[model samples]
Target: MKCWWEHLMHLPDDLSEMGVVLSRVNNSYTAASGEPVNTVQTVSSISNREVNSTDSEHSSVIPIQSKVCEPEEVLIPALPEVACMERGYVTPQQVYNLLNAEEGQPALYDPYYILVLDCRSADRYKDSHVVTARASVTVIHPALGCLISCIELQKYCIILLYAEYGCSPVGSVKARADAPDLQRCFFQLSDLGMDPVILLGGFSAFHALYPFLCTPRMVLVEPERHMLTIYPSEILEGALYQGSATQASDYRIIKNLHITHVVNATANCPNAFPNTLCYLRLRLTDDGQQDLVEALPLASRFINAALKADPAGRVLVHCSMGRSRSSALTLAFLMQHRQWSLLHALRWLKERRACTAPNLNFLRQLITYEEQLFGSRLTSLDDIRR
Candidate 1:
């Protein structure tokens, strides 16, 4: 008999023809270790994922997979990892998301979990810099070298660097003498395994968008001292929020975002604020075993209902980490509601979120969903490249 993946992923089916002792019993797949393997479609989706390969051409993730991975390891790149692999850049909005605090998550306090390094010239940095951001070169306080060595830099969850202007890519200026210190600071952090991202628009872009968040003071106000509650990611303009357990129980955040309806998209996470908010809990796991095709339309109907309820009515779709299950559901919603292809839907969502990575099996299921919806997976890896 053929391997389960051969049927599910539509692989060449020649792998089963190889000398392998693989058999499916009662719809259960077992690997060589005899462990009840859930799903191993990584090999089936490598052409679509972002990788740290030698070839820079396929370095970035475009949210479509058409290759495979070895059973021993999977290196699916989700930005900022994807961004790290090639662009070495991230949007300032993604930076704000990391700094935005949650009830149960790490604190961004005295020993800040998220470090913002201002990689500007000493003179420029001293005049004014982003609040809580340290200068790459020491002007007043510890320099970049001192901070990296003195502090447990690796402990920080998110690390960011920015220059005077970040509107353009660094390639145009990297060859210039005494250019911005963005490259040095970026590499040092990368060497430590703490993936750092250069702010896409830099200080100029950030300050313009959020003048209130930017400041000359290297200190935080009383309000800023405490971690800020996370606002949901805007999946669409119509008050739709894609989020996690962080904002699930925060009534203030929910109300602030005008999120009256919630789609609890996890098997473990409870329906927070059920009494106050409209709820549709899809008890799903983060793994690939659970099929999401049928539930996608169910979620679509529920989301539409909320929008129809009132012009101001909003919906929140959340799982535990707000990465896998929730991301998949959000992609499906776009495909069904906006009539977007899978690649188009994924791209739209990923632009707003760096954490929008659906697991491999969920990806296969989505492909099946697209084939059923639009007749075939006509969007190829080449298509995604274009």
Candidate 2:
């Protein structure tokens, strides 16, 4: 006996060819042409109907059973293990600092090393892009060759991908359609074993935040408004001091605090005490996006060496503002020297310096460093919030 679905499949393409008028009644289909055509009820509806209600004339009808087709399993190729730092997100301020870093300077993390790709349209990219950004329609196949060539040349290349607003703008019907393609490009680059970071809030947000840095024609704003005053605070009893550039420059305060060493955590922040004090200048940026992982070990060594040099020696760590960068290094020092957990060290520092807190990315790197030292993570997202 033929199945009901098989019979329906054999129907004429033009239903009118057989002079048949197909109509549905309740859960069953009926064909009205000559006499009342008895059709097999659907598998679902068959159980619901009374079996005895079927006439002897329709006894030959066969009910078809529905079978579900299972989806085929697919194997995805694993990406090669590239020895690279975790590429997360960068901000406009960090991008600006990277572009403005002085030439021939020794930087812990070089922004020039990373390849910034603007994923906007060609016209939009032509109008303006981040100072060092390259325009790309797609970063998959065609761009892969160039990227691979750069890798072969041993050019430590990290890819930074950004779209218009990090996502399709609201009410942008066309952009919404193409949003998935942009995301696919990012993932494809990652799958190709390249370190890729997506800029947070994208080009629009960056342009709004740093318009002067974005285009050449934009005028520079006043510096005083952006300038932050320094106030050195004690991290350890007398061994560690965390402060800003201003605080580090104040010779009177340095003398009063009995400081012997200074750790400058800014890219081009000059050494205030040239011959008077021992100095270790780390070409670091205060921006949250700057890579603190690479600088952690070096900064820790400097702090430890300073403390080990003399029992009474005092080290002062400072950046443009002593809040983020200096605090991060101080935390790293405590974690490395005292073998304290990241959270415990942060809590200890916070007790002395109320404003001691690293940027989100720097804190994440500290967490990573903590895990590297210990066997597991000692801090979590909730701990950071506290």
Candidate 3:
């Protein structure tokens, strides 16, 4: 008798297409009569030739053999139910709502709830954590096992995990250390059938975005107290004051800087300055998906009009973060007025404001806008020569 390996080597490549089912029983493998086999097993083939008496047709059948081994005790790990397998990223605001929802709330009753797990060191968590987050040591299995048991009792639970600012944030581009403890905990809980999501930007980003909601912990060190006021940075003398939403709200900052016009670039975020200043609201989202191109022409016209309207005319362009959307608009206005390429405009802005990185998509749109205005791409021979 030929070995199983030898038989497998001679089997047809199109055996699957032949509508034959291969199965393994005990120590031997056999091919089913008509249907295809779907059993998991190693396959071997044997050729048997037979001639039909009535039709005088030659038919070939291949028999398969499987290797057998001694039976051994096998244990399978239990997986969580399908309902508890939800995992993804959740925004800071979503996490906040989950923690703040009142008892007997409409959607947040019994089956639907949220649990925030702070996976940082005990000391760091003691320093600060989200108001409702539970600081737990996640490096060990017992700690995670206890959390999993509690999660199993809940009908529908959303488990949010967070650490320091180094973990992936909503709008951050920086990289950080590999968080093995957090990863291990997430996997273990997920395997046991629990819905989990990483809080994007972690506690640091969350704290920065929603400082009012954070707990009052001991000040580790007397870090420089940077006031939250938005002081407008002068881009063009008497022409522009680029800053954040806080600055836009600061009438004193606006008045002291002699800002005659205001361009609000945030969507749904109201303009803080009064009607005394000329207002142009773009209503753009600060994320990468915002259509900065759609508002470019209008924003440029407003900024240019402000500058040309008076020698002392100054316009303040601002967004919620004063980073992505506001910076893109400011760049657009500079490119339009100064006839500078996008690269040159960005360099100039960065020199004035170190934190002016427009999101990737917005930067791409600025390149397209540059091409539209200058009749060439953002980078040209003139730029390279300079």
Candidate 4:
């Protein structure tokens, strides 16, 4: 008899050959591992024979003896850890399962809490953010220096961004200035009974990841003439619009993009001239009955016009911050295009943009409004907007 193990080692990508001991037994023997291990094909005629590697003449006979049972099939992919490191995720199948599952499961085999933080700017979020996410603070502006803060704070869940990847990505880009710090942040936070999943693409990705959980930022405004403005030019003064600066967060971003309309959702502002700015604002409330019926559709129209009129011309729809109102309007645009139902629309949107929180009240009102308009007609954010 010849040694089967020696010949098995030469096969390509064979895990069984990589030392998964295949011990043969009586015909009635069941595998203790219960993993559906198949028996050797020629088990009936096989006789136990241990061949020593020191014996050089047995090489030729070994090949014939080992050709009995073919190698077990490779069912799933053996993903490389390094490949996962570059993509910032385990697998597309895993991400899809996560997105599709209605309820989230805890970390495998361990009771852990996931912490997600909104780290846009230190000045903006100074001493702010979800309390559960304090593992470390890594700022996403002016060279991304918060690596130490994250390590010290032990932040587990970190969502870093400032005006859409406009900031951060600094600190010798060759060494993964932002992501490396996130990895360290999670590792440190893991020490404190927490598990972190940093938003890979920023808060936008988180918003996309969980849209139904979003709350809308309210903008209470008084109707002026026929449109709405988040903050009047006089009120904005030095706070809202800024001069030409590629990196600054101001009206210049809209102007440089040659946007036609600047739809402001902030309430209580008097109107004024365009003044190199984009378009006018459309309020979302009148006598408090969710003014979005008038505002949302108009916003949809303006965005459509902006995109079609120039395609490159951008439309900046904003409230006090870019979190709520702007996000809602953008979502509306997306719903209109995709014809998705309100729930599905919200779900899909969050899976793509996660920095938003659709206020529960706002969501209810939008759903109600959509239902009332369609009246037994299947409606979604996408259906109404388009």
Q: Name the candidate that leads on TM-score.
A: 1
Off by over 4 Å in 3: 1-230, 380-386
Please give the ranking of all candidate structures by lDDT, highest first, separated by commas. Answer: 1, 2, 3, 4
Clashes of each: 11, 0, 2, 36
TM-score of each: 0.48, 0.40, 0.40, 0.36
TM-score of 4: 0.36
For residues 47-72, what per-residue lDDT tens digits would candidate 1 score against the true structure?
A: 23221111122121112233322112
Residue pairs with backbone atoms closer than 3 Å in model 2 (clashes): none
Model 3 over residues 12-65: C-alpha lDDT tens digits? 455523433334344244555543333221111122321111111122243332
Tens digits of per-residue lDDT for model 2 on 204-275? 888875554344221212242123122366566557878778778888768766788777787766878755
lDDT of 4 at 176: 50
The weakest ten consecutive residues by lDDT in model 3 span: 49-58
Error of 4 at 243 (Å): 18
Q: Each prediction's Cα RMSD?
A: 17.7, 31.0, 31.7, 28.9
Candidate 2, run of 10 with poorest lDDT = 45-54
- lDDT of candidates 1 onward, in order: 0.60, 0.58, 0.57, 0.36
